[model samples]
Target: MSLTVRILIGLALGLASGIALAEWGAAWEADAVAIAQPVGKAWLGGLQMPLIPLIFALLVTGITQAAATARGNRIAGRAIALFAMLLLAAASAAALAGPLL
Candidate 1:
């Protein structure tokens, strides 16, 4: 079978097992807590581990590239101007909605 089929089967099996455990109050239920909670925490930690360096690398690369290209400042300025316009539009919409409610 293909990988997609295998993944779907695994998800179905997992859902079935979870429902069975919930019904039976089995060891699998307890194991789910023990396994899932720490694994989830560790997975989140793993994700966070690379975030700072990745963000810094991306930012530095972007800035360096922008500096090298003359249009970087203009692009950044336009982005800021567009963001300010959107913020003002959002605020105005909210203000108009508040009085109607």
Candidate 2:
């Protein structure tokens, strides 16, 4: 009923369908990849279309708001740390998963 539940259901279904396709679509894998890959990329590009501007807007807003208070420095530090940690975690996951894949 909620957005989170819907997203979770979508993720689960996507995974299930992807697994089913991978297992049973071997004969058509090339065609499937040829078609699906571009569609997937287009979907991803659509999703990312607003990301850069949104991030830039948020970053500017944060900087402007933080400039007025001393606590903003601490908040900014924590945000940067969190961002770094997320980047590190992503890199670590890619590093670990690359060999397996």
How many residue pairs clash in all the candidates, one count each? 0, 0
Q: What's the CA error at residue 30 for candidate 1, in Å? A: 3.1
Candidate 2: lDDT over CA atoms? 0.75
Worst 10 residues of 2 by lDDT: 51-60
- The lDDT leader among the candidates is 2
In candidate 1, the residue pairs with backbone N, CA or C atoms under 3 Å apart (3 or more residues apart, or in different chains) clash, namely: none
Q: Quote the positional error of residue 53 for candidate 1 in Å.
A: 1.2
TM-score of each: 0.57, 0.47
Q: Write the per-residue lDDT of candidate 1 for residues 11-96, one digit (tens) a residue.
A: 99999987887888975677669978988988987986665556555655665577568767777556556655665676678669
lDDT of 2 by residue, 1-101 (tens): 99999999999999999999888877878887899898998898799667655765576567657755756777676665665566567667876996698
**lDDT (CA) per prediction:** 0.72, 0.75
Clashing pairs in 2: none
Error of 2 at 35 (Å): 1.0
